[model samples]
Target: MTSVSEGRIHGGAVPLITRGPLRTTLRAGDGVRIEAVYEPCTAGAAAADGAAGAGTAIVLAHGFTGSADRPAVRRAAEVFAQRAAVVTFSFRGHGGSGGRSTVGDREVLDLAAAVAWARSLGHRRIVTAGFSMGGSVVLRHGALYTAPGVREEGGGRTEAHGEAHADAVVSVSAPARWFYRGTAPMRRLHWMVTRPTGRLVGRYGFRTRIDRRPWDPVPLSPVEAAGRIAPAPLLIVHGDRDPYFPLDHPRTLAEAAGGAAELWLEPGMGHAENAADESLLTRISDWATAR
Candidate 1:
């Protein structure tokens, strides 16, 4: 990390400020290289453009098989950039990043890196918004990084440092529990990550690399994680027509939060980033700003 004036830091070789967009690679706590991009808030952005928040940086987490360069992720980033600075990154084994994807297991470290990078860029307030698999990550990341006295088995985790925590979290189309195969899309997704032949399809068809190893101790579920995210505001958004996880997923998460989270069920919406439209993004931006 490169230190700059006023106590700001730059991850890898990325400078404090750049002429246009800032694109660079960040090293996670576990030494995985994550590909990330930083886009400053645009001038003269209107509320319709989702420009209600300022001086806040949103660390955008993409869903499984999604990357910073993906069309859906890029569109979301573009809309959020109008309101606040936006940081988008690819988890390990996705896009140009290093290592294999542990699904959402080790991806929390990737999000931690991005959040820390957002702080280093001088954003005092950080909001994390994720979709689908990324939504599960934001929930777990918020719980691990923000809740006081929380400790994991790994000694080198980023939670103790406090720099990776998000001031606000938005989970869109996330699941409450783990290892759920109720829906066909989820079952196919499971096969894609767990089976050798399906992993090939993930690589060639989706351009995502999957790690064959299962979770050693199985991390906290999204519902359990949601319970810990108090003080920090949480917004749970789910589509009524989501094919992956049913409405029960978001309901469980909101219930687990014990009224600390706000749940929004979008009518006719499907799943993840591809399903998140402009109006919903506008409302999300407004919510983050209010926090």
Candidate 2:
């Protein structure tokens, strides 16, 4: 992985390697092709290795305009795989995946597909970690699919029957409320440039483009979906100095969760700035695996 500014790691250059010799692939409802790097954990292996109880599985999703090959995704994948099974895939219109971006409205379906795929592989316990837009996708998925559903072509069945399908959700730098007026100054500037730019790009048939559709024109907003995820174990991580969605976004989400959620505010951290914080990541992983 190449090192970028703000200690961010970019995994686009590196190829994904799975534990076993074989690999897995899935197709979304929209015919978007998706790939997953899987690591199998047999009952015997779990018995031999005391750390494999319950067959914990983690699905990592990248942010807007990012693919599964991003550094943050790779890092989280490696960390979670050591403890349990790990599957990371690209969102539609990004990386090797297909289809246009839906600003996370439809991407939640993609995440649900990923979770089902992991469960099909015999993962009894599942957790999803998403960064930026990916974070929003996981939250939306938790809100939308409160009950178990039939697995997609290559996906697995939902783990729970009702209100128990998703065990836990972790969102990093996710904007809880999309169209709030209390945005920070830098974010306001971004909106100023992105809104007009999105409309202009839409005129040229680039509206569904990953970058333009989500940020520029404000695609699917997550704030409206926050209330739907209450009573679920939600983790909202944000930097106190975040210039993107503003720290208030997470704070509001935590309050909305009504004591069912936890918020971790990194002092002086900026947007996606905690990519290199291994301790924080481990803490989140532990929370995901804990009963």
Candidate 3:
């Protein structure tokens, strides 16, 4: 069950705002505590300004090492809030959330909790937008939650029935497959995830706690998940210059969807939330609303 509490917005990276966002602690189905924030829509096109999206809500899943309070995550929330209410949360092991990071393996439960909360708040439409590691998560979450009879790898039934299903999904700068060491950035990330000393760096330098255990049964790949998110709108956005995953990642995802998804190959954009400019964000917001 998820509980609400008044949360203050602070930290040097966060910009001063006239209104404070609603903060709460979300308990995932597995009982991990997730830190989340809800920002009301400020756009003029909506029926009521600051009415919490009126009818729509966008849930944001940040990349590895990112938190709801990060400047980049807040910036994306601010932009999306122009079109709909926004939900942003820190994955387990990041920010003030509990539990160690399972990388992308068990993070699906965190996203599910956030989406269910958004639905409970009376939003008719819920869209999920994820970046980097988060990008892969949203895809898998959409597949596991929206599709019936889809199970986890080890004969475990995914809790597919719930309000956790997203009406639409957006993935930015996510990898197609796991254990990709082709790029230098990806190699460094693997080191941070696999090595003991590297986990220390993740904890101290990045404020992210890495889980030391390996996946007992690997989860679905992003490409495979994309194929199952049909009948629901899916948007895959990737940068040509993304140092993490190349253009091929988005391409494979688009192809896997069997023409059911939209693919955008951005020019000169780097990676994740930090690289998402206002113009691009505005376009993404427009796309979500138009669907």
Candidate 4:
């Protein structure tokens, strides 16, 4: 972890070592590396005692421009750890992971690798949760990879059991459509910084000097991928007062998921606000354990 004078911490060499369960690094097909953190389900343990009977695990992903150490990510991990194993890692170039950030385009592959790592650890029941851009990755995972339970444990016949899929998914303050239609404030910010400064930061690291492309392409849109997660439980939580994404983003996702998914609208809450809310944390814990 290298610190910059401007207070921005870049995570590349500093690795997060976890001993609670198991820790590993996954190398994606695209040559990007992802760190995987896991906590096991133990009987009578402080967190998983309540969820010990479920035998489930959670694979968590952080939002855009944020790492696994973000406050929200840590809080959610602690909450979920009470009942089940919690796994989180940095997407490419964001935290201790390698490679440059491609927005959410290639990040999806990092997420897939994380999920695969979780499955290898004997997590038959898996639930994936992501924040903002990370949420978009969860939705994309549902579309690209069949949920964990889609196949039988040993060699039995594949069943259409809803439990076979990700029992539950949570997305916080995610944007349904950012590349095409973003909020006014977000558009203004993009116009102000994306042209020159954003390009410079992306090209020559955060503090270096260089010129790069104006806009990074969006390969996957939440609105387009929402419908693909059908038959699996999905939850979209967004702030009504979010300045970057329109309030309708969550609603659009809910509608796209048909009745299988639901949306929670947080009044007066900005983006990522619910992450610090005690009540919201409890709700997330309860929801994840219900499966």
Top TM-score hit:
1
Q: Which one wins by TM-score: 2 or 4?
A: 4
* Clash list (residue pairs), candidate 4: 11-95, 47-82, 47-83, 48-82, 149-164
Per-prediction tally of clashes: 0, 4, 0, 5
What is candidate 1's lDDT per residue for 1-291, written digit by digit as tens?
111101112355445533368888888767778999998876444632554565688899999999999999999998887677899999989999999998888888889889988887777789999999999999998877863354544543434247788899999999999999999999999999989999999999999998888887788788999998888899999999999999999999999999999999999999999999998997887788779
Kindly list the per-residue Cα lDDT of model 3 for residues 1-291, writing each as its tens digit: 122111211221233221446788887767788998988677644435434345788999999999999999999999999888888999999999999998887888889888877766667788999999999999998877763444534453334335678889999999999889999999999999999999999999999998998876778888999998877899999999999998889999999999999999999999999999999998888888777
lDDT for model 1, on a 0 to 1 scale? Answer: 0.85
lDDT per residue (tens digit) for residues 228-277 in model 4: 67666788888877877877789888888876787889887787633447
TM-score of each: 0.89, 0.73, 0.88, 0.76
TM-score of 1: 0.89
Error of 3 at 32 (Å): 0.2
Which model is ahead, 1 or 4, in terms of lDDT?
A: 1
TM-score of model 3 relative to the true fold?
0.88
Q: Candidate 3: where is the Cα deviation over 4 Å? A: 1-20, 49-53, 147-160
Q: How close to the true structure is residue 167 of candidate 1, measured as C-alpha lDDT?
A: 92
